[model samples]
Target chain A: MNDTSTAKTGLQSEAGAAMKQNRTAEGTVGEVYVDDPRMTCRNVDVYYGEKQAIFDVSLDVGKNQVISMIGPSGCGKSTFLRCLNRMNDTIDICRVTGQIKMDGQDIYDGGLDVVPLRASVGMVFQKPNPFPKSIYDNIAYGPRIHGLCDDKQHLDSIVEKSLQRAGLWEEVKDRLDQPGTGLSGGQQQRLCIARAIAVSPEVILMDEPCSALDPIATAKIEELIDELRENFTIAIVTHSMQQAARVSQRTAYFHLGKLIEVGETDQIFTSPRHKLTEDYITGRFG
Target chain B: MNNQQQHQKTMERVQQGLDRRYRKERHFRWLGLGAIILGLLFVSFLFITIISNGYTAFQQTYVKLDVFYDPEMIAPIGETDPEVLSRANYGGLIKASMRQMFPEVTNRREKKVLYGLISTGASYELRNAVMSNPALIGSKAEVWVVADDDVDMLIKGHIDLRLPESDRRIKDNQLGWIHLLQEQDRIEKRFNTTFFTAGDSREPELSGIKGAIAGSFFTLLICLTIAFPVGVAAAVYLEEFAPKNRWTDLIEVNINNLAAVPSIVFGLLGLAVFINFFGLPRSVPLVGGLVLALMTLPTIIIASRAALKSVPPSIREAALGIGASPMQTITHHVLPLALPGMLTGTIIGMAQALGETAPLLMIGMVAFIVDVPGSVMDPSAVLPVQIYLWADSPERAFVERTSAAIMVLLAFLISMNLLAVWLRKKFERRW
Candidate 1:
């Protein structure tokens, strides 16, 4: 928090002002949490080789609360969401330098193992990936690998309960042995959510989970998200401003790799404090 | 000049351009189709020629003869001893039996014709007869021995008896005896089990592919065992874990180059390293298999990497995001999905290895072996080397044997490729 404003912000420089203006906009950044946070990210900077993706982005995911990050494309919303669980480690050229803490422990410490860290902070991707296994196996994968259940009956119950929580159990009960890829796109996404929850994670980071779905499936997922927040802390990155307003209790608007403004979902949509956030929400220029 | 006229002119030009482009596209497609048809036709011609020339080798001709196993002639001591029977002049007995069959042929040249009807290996049958049944040592027994190459060709109708005697390998006098044997029902054609049961022999009828087949089997077995695990591990390391650096890049380039290297060069390497340096037995399936494994490893690795690449990145992300470690993710997910393609590639490499001759030849597998290889450590000659040996022989009957060996090799290759196709179909993920 102490390094928030002065350390970064290259838009106001005299040199390259005209060229940078297209991608950079003035914004205020802070981690606004109403209650104790399950996780905290401070002054996070992401770079892909020479190009910096996220600049001095600070955020907090409130315990058992749903926080949605909304921005236009290339605004680093998804990149910052991935930073919570270190999902960006998959990219060879991607480099992240920052402080990320989960449950009072440093997630990015050199000795910290990524396996348990990922297990604690599970993720649902922009696209549904069901591991080319059966629906039951897909949900059982996390628990089986983590040894959460000792026997087959216990693993089966966990899978059943997770699928029930995702609201896909009734639809897929008889076809648990069928390939998860055979499901509809929306069902596949729900299966992914079930897979993430089966691990019993403390937090779930979703990167545009419903972007590929139609209106009906999207509405169902938004409803499911509201229910999921009661059990697990959630952070989602989305392109739709209405979705952010609908699903999240707190909304953080990002512009040009910087958090433009953050407040409660109601206040941010009703009266955004930053001009860029207001402009982005009012559909003036995204 | 007017706006409407300008628009019409532009439309006309666009229409002409579209027509010209369509014609070009059509011409290119036809050219491609023609090339494919020509290639297929050439392959069909080769198959037809081989099938027609080689199908006869699957059956061999035999002649039934009555041999008087006079105990005095075989063993003067009147004993059923293996040494006495083995030392007996069975070649003289074969010639004398043929003379008894045609008592009217007394001229020296005509006696030569009668001698030509029975194989020189007829003595082998006589020796085997006395050795197996010592009771036959003093008795007259009727045994069906193999016919000579000239008589077999004449009976099979491969030789043109209608031609002048000077122009035919089967002389007119030989054909008269062949017809007499036909009338007496003494000559018969049976399924050539010997072709599958014996090894290379100087006599065409006695030669078979059993040795080469066993050698190929052992070599491929070793190749699969070593190449699969090592190739898969190398592929996983290169694909999933290896850092992108100049060192890795160099290793990748060399792997690809090794894949393209000639099989003979590998033979030379095997000779230098395995035979000279390690002092392993020459012409053994063990050294041949090691060489084949080296040759196939690159292909397996490349194929496995491709299969790993085909797996969507989202699957990797999902597994990692779920707390599975890197090795776990591969073993649990990536490797399972990539295995089908890996196996397919391995089979293709094995098929190529099975047909490999130059490397095995250089490693001394070109030696004429008369016994089927019983183990990998035994001196062996694979099918391709047998085919090479037959192809190089001066005997006219060896032509049929060469093509027949090729047919067997092709059968193995086809089955391997078919297995690969079936595996791909069975395990391929739609995702």
Candidate 2:
């Protein structure tokens, strides 16, 4: 692997110049700085009844970037991802504390409805779960509920585009009316991804999307994940260190409910940092 | 060299022991399979016996009779009083008709034995005919009606009078007269259409199950109209909306316990509450249906809850995540998935209610009803109670009828269970 600390500085400068151009387009002279993170978490703790599953962990997720959470088993990485979308609320015993915000708005505010919040922040589960419906219906469910489609033609177009973006359009276009479950495992996962994207969510959370797939399918999903970052903010939880290094710009390493380290993925993988991170990367201990 | 020989001998002994164990295991496997096959055969034998003994009861024997009504005895010297004619004793009418047919009978006891050959309802039929048409009071008319049980059995080969007069309900003289009538083509066995068309009666020879069949139909109608919506609503609330707490858990346990409670207890409760407290008429199909509904509620609730639980949580999460409200999630996603299971449970519960006799007996559904129930509130008798009443009768003919009724009940139950199984197979989706 190339040591690219100097190249990283160059990329940051280029991103800064792009942001300046984005501001000037609207005739705005940076009157209000974009300092507020797209999602901000502080001292968030999760518990399953009396057992605390995630300790005090704080993080920031920027808009339009890929953030990967990587850790060993039982490290609460999946738990944290669930917290982001309030998916933990489905579990009766799971309790979450501390503030999580999106666009400077507290997501867990009592008056806010979790339904639309989840619509804005969609989720793909660890295992591919396709509804026992036609592939078209599965993709249409989210959009139909959110009223994103104006007519049949519009809904059809949305389904086509979503599948195309998920890199599964060519294989499934002719059989959109078939049962979603009739597809192969990799195809089903892609269908789920296409389903999540159909709602046009601002952020998509994938909890080990490729864990149940073979090497070829995993490589395809990794390529799709790289393509997806251009349109939506993405948070992925994976156990594979190489996946974290390849797809994510920033990686957060969790160990036993604690955020052991969070930094540039390349820095975390190559440089000496926290002892736990080092021990985990070198395969001495996880 | 001595140590090497010892090692070889030990290896041979170990292999021999392994082979013996394997042979014993194989023998036990065959024994277990044989035991299972024997158990299945035993169950099959029981079912075959029930079907064989019950099949003969469906076919019944009948005799066509023409009775000549005497004008003097019925119209009574031009008085033309309907009350007098209605009160006129019909038993004497039947006996006089028998004596006129067989004028050779001189003994009073022998005449009485001959009178037993026709049903008591035969006199009622003659009376009804005369009363309906006063002009026919003086004319002679022939009526086709059911013969008495002994006469029926004799024609059906269930009776033999050659044994002895003291040992038989029908004597040799009566049998000889019946034989003469048979030779003259007066007594002929016809298809028993009355068994299906007529209603229940106190007289065993004239009784039919039309009343009870109507009663069962009305009762089930009321049950389905009441139990299905209420049971499904309660289940959805408890399963999807209620928080996990001690109160909900207690309710859950009570529902399971209620399912296990004896059905007769529901009958007693209905008796005390619906009949005595609420003043609903005794023996009404509505009351019986309400009692059955109470008995089947817990079953429906438990089954609906299980169906709801079987739906994967991801489906609900997906719906809610898409801005669908809790009610929307349930109505749009959950209920459709669980409908087949709910229907299966409802049908099975209804079948169980169809066969229930004890609870119905407690609530007065066992009463003899000669008219078919016209409304939900009308007095009626259900099929199981009809069977119970028939089985308790001292008449030998009722025994066969009871078995026939049982066969009909079994047919209904089998069809209902088959429908449930078919529905489950058709609509149960795997995710």
Candidate 3:
């Protein structure tokens, strides 16, 4: 472990040309503004202790639109997505310095409590975590904690509706009392998404939601995301370019902690602007 | 042909290697079994020796007697005066009655020996009988009296019966009388309620363990109440909220060191702090419990921290991701998953506290307490210190009583461990 820094030094000296190509973008490209955006972020920078992970990047998430962030590993796409819900605050060494406004209110304001903000912008992690509770409790926890229901029947209907929207109701309806961990991996991830939506969150942040699923399960979740966009704004980070093209209307491509380009998925895929963007899309080098 | 021969040789080598591995695995299994057997053998031997020595202490020998309370000899000033009745020589009355039973003994020393058959404390029985009903001052009544410790030991078969007359506590004449009494059904072995009801006494026949048991109970109650929540809270602060800095690291290191300190040192600490400075009463379970709690805090804190650490970080993330505050996340999710482990640690600490002696000894818990403690602050002799006090006495009867006290203590400690195991099994979660 102690030799890692020296090893990195040796690799960088030999691979100078590769290091130069991994540079920050001049600024955010493509249509950085959208009409009636739900969340507007500007000049965001993220740091981990002494190291910088994200540069100045700006973007707009339109209301009722599916925005998928596609990038290679360590490209800051996941870090940027976590900032939308202030999930980075959980990590002690991490620091986020940027203006991420939701509904024209500064989320980073000192007086604003992170509790209500997180409830409005719920999150789904990469690996499914279901609170070690029953499947029914997994879906009801969000609403119960927020006090969004009047009675037990109201809570039950909310759980059912959320599960139905996430396409996991039929598979788990008969055994709602069973532990959420007993479900298959695909079903577990869908349950987590349903758990996020139970509070009726206006926006849903999914961090590599289907990265651990089979192609069939991934197709099912992509369909769910498409249908979810009719009500809630959705932001997802993914590695698969085709998944972004299939599910999201706006495609944000991140490279070296910078938003290199973001536009209509069809436009970015068919006709890329930057040389690095075209090379990355054409499988030259990640 | 050469290639085929080479292939056969290689296969034979592989088979030999596999056989050697199987033999090694079998040898390792035998080693573990041998270790377990050794542990079980030692533990069983301890129980056997203790039960064989102490089980008889629960039953004592008694002698039935019929005494006539002559009013003129008992109360020369008349029974109407309660003060004069209180000073009546009940001991002389019992001895005179004993003399009547064995009229053949003419030697003055032998008569003294004859009178010594009944317990010294038995005189109190007659006094209580007459004092409660003054009308019985001149009446004849049959009553059961406690036998002396020497006779009790002889009846329990603990004394060497074949020893020379000069070396034994009971002479041939006394043994002959015991036999005659046994034949006439005057000697009876009765359930020893005194062993459970009375407190520490110089006479083995009159001593009991109720005072020490109560002391141990009060001390343990205070010890658990003070140590558990404080230990857990300290652990939670260090594990969850406290920033990783030099001060916290130093505190952690000191806690580890404190668990290794000798228990007697804690007693000295209590002596200086609780007794001398704080002016709390000496020999009370309250002060002893505070000392014991101080000694056990490090153990509980270390265990609780480990329990909290065993929970996966993913659970914390899930709670925070779903909008629960940090405090809410810990209370609702992390603490529940960590509870079984924490309880297991607490029980272990309590067991250690239960068996503690040197610290209480230094804190003056070795005093002869005669009454069951009514409150935590009452002076009492805890079980281990009582055992220590009994073990030091130069009496053959006390030897058995010491073993009996140990058995009771072991029973309590074993049940505590069993409770910890049961709770862990009942509440342990898979995730």
Candidate 4:
């Protein structure tokens, strides 16, 4: 521990030249767009009643890649993620003014229905909130509501395949009739993941899905995220910088409701361009 | 060292006050326990008083008589007609049997007193028996007939026999006759089936609460059918769909105030609207039920709203996050989670409706009803109203019947509360 602390301090002082005293400039540093994007967000501002929560944020989520958003508490990362699927509409006073396009079509258009949009872009909460039902029912809920299956047999296959993809089939196969809430914390999170996948969504938004689990469970989820990236574009907001470095190809750093930096994960962690991002990644302050 | 000495002084002060602190705590605990014990004492006292006062009403006194139903006396018109047989002087037959048993009562007034031993309802009983079996005309059968209400009170020790003959309803001559009948085993007490099967009557011994029970059943059926769905729907709309604004707040306040409104005012409203304006018949369960439903609506709505509110918001979010519509989410997730609470509330409201009497009284349900109600439109009495009417009577026997009716009402209330508890326990889920 002492050797690592000395090494970290040595590294911090060497990169201390990038740190600036006035860190209030609002423009984002590094790359904010990708060559091939699945979803594009530009000039997004969010407000709760009269209080502005996010100001003029722009970023791109590349196709079939995991982008990790790391920020302090109340930094608007989760709020921005909720805006992607229009989940913020459930709030009475929340208002969003921006253009978010999925495949070059505006998602916030009045003609667009949130039902199909949510079905395509599913979310997993920070807490592993499995429905108080059987494991089989939990997995089949999405497909049943969306009318994606032709018959009971097809629904059964979808439930089985979703669970297999989430890496929870072997553990829970014998107890498909047991309540989803009766599972361990890690298994419950995976069940939520399998539930999201049951609808065959194109993108999965995860809001600190492993914050409520132990180290072993976090490792298991990190592994599952790597496996899920082959078929789905994933955006995850995390409090842990190590988790962002481990599972993401792109990293976005938010500070006080502003997107401070967005760049390749290896470059952002190794050589941060913005002072706020350098200070945040170096454990100087949140 | 000086700092340590100051700390020791503070510790010493605390130690000195510890006993006083503990004494106060003990005093508070004992005060709470005393309050609970006082409440329990009152409840037990009430139950004991009711049970002791009412238990004797379950048994009725009967007089055994050997009546020779002669065909000559029964069909004196010689028509062999059912109407003539039913109109036969069954009272004279009982008189003859009593004369045979007590041959010394030859004076006219003594004969009148002797005839008073059997209830006037017994003549109707005998007439019905003879009507059902015309062949019984020539038979001599020993039948146990209901004694008069005064005789019942005397046999049950409610009538003070120590009082002077002039002060007693049962005179000296009546006592002598009852003693003689008791010695011969001719007088007996049996389970009062008449009290359960018969309807209201001028004679206390012939009256029962069967009509009131039937009326209560119909009234509560109508009340639940009207109140449950409408109350639940109103609660769901207010809690889930309506925006939280001044209008809904005012409505919420009005509903709460309505629950506290006097029930008699509702009775007056029922009289004006249902009986006068709508021209519904007086003294029927429909109007009574309508009145009770109006009274119980606020209670049901409040309970259902609380039940809906108890469902964690996370469940609603989970459903909505999965692309389920608002209606679908509430129906599939929120409603199922809240149903146990709603049903519990509805049962409690029904129990409250069952015990209500004042509103029913305003609608004229206090009138004497003879036949058990066959439909909601029939003139009827409810249990509480029956108890009220009986309690106002001058008869000693009616007092016991009043308490017995109260016991029945209490039993219905306790069982409904138990059912509510069981339902809540059975469906109480953990998040």
The fraction of correct interface contacts reproduced by each prediction comes to 0.89, 0.52, 0.63, 0.50
Give the Cα error of residue B30 in candidate 1, in Å. 1.9
Top candidate (lDDT) = 4
**Ranking of predictions according to DockQ:** 1, 3, 4, 2
DockQ of each: 0.80, 0.43, 0.61, 0.57
Candidate 3 chain B minimal-lDDT segment of 10 residues: B76-85
B-chain TM-score for every candidate: 0.91, 0.81, 0.91, 0.96
Model 4 lDDT per residue over A1-286, tens place? 4643564465455435554333322367778889999999999999998777887899999999999999889889999999998889888889999899998989999999988888889889899888889999999999999999999999999999999999999999999999999999999999999999999888999999999999999999999999999999999999999999999999999876778788899999999887778889999988
List of clashing residue pairs for candidate 2: none
Model 1 ranges with Cα > 4 A deviation: A1-33, B1-4, B67-96, B106-113, B126-142, B161-168
Question: Which tens-of-lDDT digit does each residue in B55-160 have in candidate 4?
Answer: 9999999999999987777874234578788778998888889999999999999989988989999988888888877778878999999999999999999998
- lDDT tens digits, residue span B1-431, model 3: 99999999999999989989999999999999999999999999999999999998888999988888888767842366667777888888888788888879889999888988999989888888777788887788887999999999999998897889999988898999899888979899899898888889999999999999999999999999999999999999999999988999999999999999999999999999999999999999999899999999999999999999998887887787778888988998889999899999999999999999999988899998888998999999988888999999988889999999899899899999999999899987765
What would the per-residue lDDT of candidate 2 be over residues A70-135, giving only the tens digit for each residue?
878998999999998898887999999988988778888998788888888988888888878899
Candidate 3 residue runs with Cα over 4 Å from true position: A1-32, A134-140, A149-164, A167-188, A211-220, A239-245, A255-261, A267-286, B1-27, B67-97, B124-142
User: For residues A1-286, what per-residue lDDT tens digits would candidate 1 score against the true structure?
Assistant: 3333343444334223322223222335333545598998777889988788898776778899999999879889998988888888888899999888998888989999899999999999999889898999999999999999989999999999999999999999999999999999999999999999999999999999998999999998999999999899999999888899889989998777877677789988997656667778999977
lDDT of 1 by residue, B149-247 (tens): 878887777887678889888887888898898898999998888889998999898899999999999988988999999999999999999999999
Instruction: Quote model 2's TM-score for chain B.
Output: 0.81
Q: State the lDDT of candidate 2 residue by residue for B18-114, as single tens digits.
A: 9889999999999999999999999778667656655544555444554555655665545457898787666565676667778898888887777
lDDT of each: 0.88, 0.81, 0.88, 0.91
Tell me what TM-score chain B of candidate 4 gets against the true chain B.
0.96
lDDT of 4 at A271: 90
Best by DockQ: 1
Q: What is model 4's DockQ versus the real complex?
A: 0.57
Q: Can you tell me which runs of candidate 4 are displaced by over 4 Å?
A: A1-26, B75-85
